[model samples]
Target: MVENMHERPGAPSAGDGLVRLYGPRFQSDPAAIYREIRREHGPVAPVLLEGDVPAWLVLGYREVHHVTSNPQIFGRDSRRWNAWKDIPADWALRPYAEYQPCSVFTEGEEHRRRGGALSDALAAVDQFELRNQVERIADQLIDTFAESGRADLMAQYALRLPVLAIARLFGLSEADAPSLAADIAASADEGEEAVRAHQRVVARMRRLVEEKQARPGADYPSRLLAHPAGLPPEEIPSDLFLTMGAAQLTTADWMGNTLRLMLTDDRFALNLSGGRRSVGQALNEVLWEETPTQNFVGRWVIQDTRLGGRHIRKGEVVVLGLAAANADSQVRPASYAHASGNQAYMSFSHGLHGCPQPAREIAEAIVQTAIEVLVDRLPDIVLAVPAHELEWRPSVWMRGLIALPAEFSPMYADRPAG
Candidate 1:
């Protein structure tokens, strides 16, 4: 057993025992539980997941580094993770095996190949096209809410913006994009049915590519249809796989977190609307402060390996503590060393398979673009509801409010400032 993680009352018990962090209270407010364990338990501690599978939740930054860096020892295959397996086959997860994209879950070169194609597309995303489309969507959303003077930002802007951006980028028709986004997100939560819905979307994208064999258009799908390397027709299916994956929840969560932070944290509001440098720092702080992913980074142990004093058996499943580890004292201070503030957050995982995008940099650009529009266009903005009352979606892997309301003067263009 590790030392007591926290000494105070209501703090969780110490050590790597089978205590449930997802237990009811922990679900309601996880921040407090994390602090309790950090104060008492060491960074890496054994956790009995679902009260059965022997697992380790690496809490401290150093331990998280250790877990993520050793992919060979810790597995990336989610199927091997027993947490999903414990669900009955008849339950939504029975077909869960087929639902996930091979890009992030698999290791080494293959993962690189799948990601490479998408990055090529990401690179190809026209700055002018993206700016033009994204701004229009922003305006569309603002227009919808302008009359009421109040609107749910999550339902209205955060969710819609990324879905629209990704839809256009992937070459999916505007008519087809919404269902695909909802289906994929559902698959993340409800399992196979949701997975099937998402799979159908992928299949549809593949069909679109095939029909365009001779008359490929100027869109993204059509470009991939005409890539110089000559992707195998079979490989085209992977494009949908990659696109479905390339820009889904990650962007949506960022939108939610950015807006939430903007509305709730006043310091963030001032700096977030500032030019690129200040905006970049603020985004980094949010990633450091509140990592949205609840799913720990997964890896399958290959050979026998002992980590953090625990022996990880061959073929055993291990997941790195993205949340716990980011909050760990060491990761923070070390990251803080270079920067002036506590901005060491890890939502995209690290080592061989972290997010390839320049997150801190691009995040500033994307949200800053949105903020500039908001500030110049609708200055006296305020949240529709009290900050504490926002609703958070459950199932530990994601941390975003389901809905956020905003209120602003509708006729800002017409009225003169006081």
Candidate 2:
């Protein structure tokens, strides 16, 4: 292991080493960072983020899973901690609330009750009625682009469906969905732009909250706002908005990544069960091979305790790289295990404080529906340009193709005279 890693008392076996988050060379290549952490240091390596945000880089799957799952030791409380994160309190509130959910950060019965309530509500979507609604939406999406025979699958097909589907979950009207979704997607990130975007959405959400409180409409948000049925309200709008954003972003990300993988990864999609299962498997591959939320902002070790290798005093931050863990081969049975769903993944996270949705089956179903439609309805479709020329959006914490440029024959309000 590199001497750069420091030692700490009572550290886990994996934590004895020098880990750094800011190196000029590593700044350009995060994959290399993961490689070094796994090959040289233990899966748990001590590091800092963006130069000074102190943390440990747990790049291996087991270590990350353990860290994420243990809320008792590694706290999820943002207010009591994360003051060093330095975003505006209001700006940070939305994303924090979204991931942590209604008392998700807490340990013991509060978490179980809140998580259980959410689970019960979410389970309601699996009913026969919701299935019909989902099927109708899936068919409608394909039909919209079906005549054209050529559509930007991400922009036209994959992106819109999840936004609308989540909107349906909230019982929102289709007419008002576009703006609402747009407003929510912006609150998912952290930075200057994220703060600005959050403020704008906060206003919109505040209006909706007040309106729902007054009128008490049929939407879940309305009922949540009113608490009419003796259900506790979970109206921290920023988080709700980010939940929507997460619902849209990761789904859209998998959609595009799935297409790219199917198109490029040795034609893996063609080998699937009648391509009947491309959506589930491909989506899994996308998460394992290239997750959207690579590094998640997290912190612990306040009041000076040992974490990773180094012993530090008060006010330190820790960032966990979920993507790195997803790709870590050590905890995985093989490099491709997560892609095959053989290993439980950091993609959906684990434990009480994890993502509050029943994301697995629902997301798979959504992806599967799209794949089924594309394979059945648009077989001749192929990438127009050599994929190497296609561009990807590069960010510290996200992985996705920015735009997919390809031409398919005879589609989308742009075909020549018949």
Candidate 3:
């Protein structure tokens, strides 16, 4: 058992056998760690967050599904967590575990009101227009380094595109998009500046809400303002902030991971150009394997319950092992070949709290269009470094490449657009 540095007397401790979710090994190869935990602890394993904070990792597909589906028992409210007293204000993971006024923490009818408004707002998005906007942004991003013949696609393209596109959707002006994008990126990092960055995001969203209220437009924020659900003015910004943060990072990582799969795997690499069919396969494969959201600080146990043959006490934290559940032998495909076209992966999560369908469609449109446009523009692009040399960002919750350096024949910025 790892020493529980934060454990206090009478506070719950998952006795002696908790796997630390942080450290170099978990950062480098989390799948291996998950497998080891599953072998030793079965479907549900006791785990420690950063700072020796104890929690349970649901490692089985069925267990994850059960937990997510039964939110009544495994609530979304993080206030129910028993370890809050042990956590410091500056804890890197606090942004996720702390309670907020957003829809993500709301339960029952409240969630329906907030979440429904968001869904309806998102559903109003013009997919065709969104795709066009994404393509234009992708091309502009590619143009930045196209003439250099080498570029880190992860930073230069994948990371920037989603936020910029989302900014437009929020009705933010062109001048504000870059700053919003940068703030969203910084807020996702587990750094000292994250809290301030998050504050800036909220401020920006609040301003956008005010603008939409005064001058409605055919945009997401405007739609939310007009929704019949009548979400409170103060509550709108929090929800909008949550929506932007969630959509931007997840979609960015989705693009980055899919690109990594295509560049690294021989099956996809062999037929890169004009392989629209292969692109779809790569996207689906990444969701099942390298899903952007690896482990979500998830459902809090509402009461004592037995899950995966282990007794969980009331008010305990239950981390949703999304990547692990996707890799579960019982549900996952034996091989990548068999995994093609299978969309049953819990990458987007499950149950009422699952990512809204409209949001998912918007993310897909952005990811698919961005990838297809890149391939169409630079048909011969290949990794500038060896496939094994690529590094993933050191984050336990999100899975994405640190940088994807690629080289291709030079295309001048002023050259005719593909």
Candidate 4:
């Protein structure tokens, strides 16, 4: 049996093998756990995921870059992976790592083709109009909870605004967007629910795509349909499925984490209230400290390679240690130094497979606008419980609060102009 690192001395470590990435232990204080793992195992730590899935988690600043930047050596296609041959097809990790027709799992000419279609679709978004949409969505969402005197920001505000914004961008009717957004959130989880969620999202996106193809509009789906990439019928929905799901989830989490930090920490609260810092600064700070997706998976080994001085066999999977890399001593001499600059952070996952939507400015606008609206509407907002008592989702990948219960003086909703 593998010895457990977290076990108290003299206690049995039997049956406890590689470090489990799931559970309350990792969820409660992942930063502390990440530091311990990096210290003992250096940059490349062998970790066991939920289903006893063994994979190397790359923790160093330079090491993560090395693996992510070299697509020739470490391919994105999980179908090439040989490690899962013996593992059950229904293993928890399969849904995330399984082959998909989208850019996340593709490489070479195929990736460029699909990725370009997505890039063009995103580039078409008018920055000015997008920011306005974000502000509008924020106001609409805030109207729902302003008079309640108390709210779970995670559910009522942080979550709703992004989906509404995405729906507007995709040209989806208000009625269809919320259900699609729910599917996106569910897709981020593990187990049978995630599988079902994936299916539902695909079906929903396919219907949207077919409708768009019949009567093309100036929105994202129509743009993708018109792109010279000439995406196949089967692949069209996959593209929408990947892009919409990614945009809604990441943007929501980014907003949620930033708001949580602002509400819980005096440093953030005082700065914002006193005008010492901008919402953009708060965003940069959160990206460095508590990036929405702490770990990115599915970079398969194309050949035997040395990553961070450790030998990795072919077909082995390497997960990007984004949150760890941002906090790595080598990247920043001191942890707190990350808050000083708005420079690039690994929160976007670098290299050819990096995220393209919600460009920096768009993300900044969405999050900044959302927070500003909340503060404007409820200036006295404060956490209903101790910051430490807030619960985090138990998933190994997602980094977000389950709910952010806050209290403030009741105010009537500001009715929108007809």
What do the candidate models score in CA lDDT, each in turn?
0.60, 0.58, 0.85, 0.77
**Model 3 per-residue lDDT at 207:** 85
| Top candidate when judged by TM-score against the true structure | 3
lDDT of 2 by residue, 368-410 (tens): 6666666665555676568776565444455556565444454
- Name the runs in model 4 displaced over 4 angstroms: 1-16, 270-277, 333-340, 413-418
Please give the range of 10 consecutive residues that has the lowest summed lDDT in model 4. Answer: 5-14
- What TM-score do all the candidates reach, one by one? 0.79, 0.78, 0.93, 0.91
In candidate 1, position 232 carries an lDDT of 61
Candidate 1, residues 1-418: lDDT per residue as tens digits? 2223342222112353544545456656766667776665456555544334455566666666666776666666665544454545544322233235545666677666755655565566566656667778777767777766677877777767676766676556777767767775665444346547656766776787786685666566666656654556666765565455435665667667766776777665533244323454555655776666655535666666655545555655555667766666555655432463554466677777776664333334456566556555566677878888887764345666778878877653356768
Q: After superposing candidate 2, which stretches have Cα over 4 Å from the reference?
A: 1-29, 37-41, 45-54, 82-107, 143-149, 189-191, 214-219, 222-235, 270-273, 302-308, 312-315, 335-343, 411-418
User: Which of the two candidates, 1 or 4, achieves a greater TM-score against the reference?
Assistant: 4
Ranking by lDDT: 3, 4, 1, 2
- Return whichever of 2 and 4 wins on lDDT: 4
- Per-candidate Cα RMSD to the true structure, in Å, reads 5.8, 5.4, 4.4, 5.0
Per-candidate clash tally: 16, 9, 0, 0
Kindly provide the TM-score of model 2 when superposed on the true structure, using C-alpha atoms: 0.78
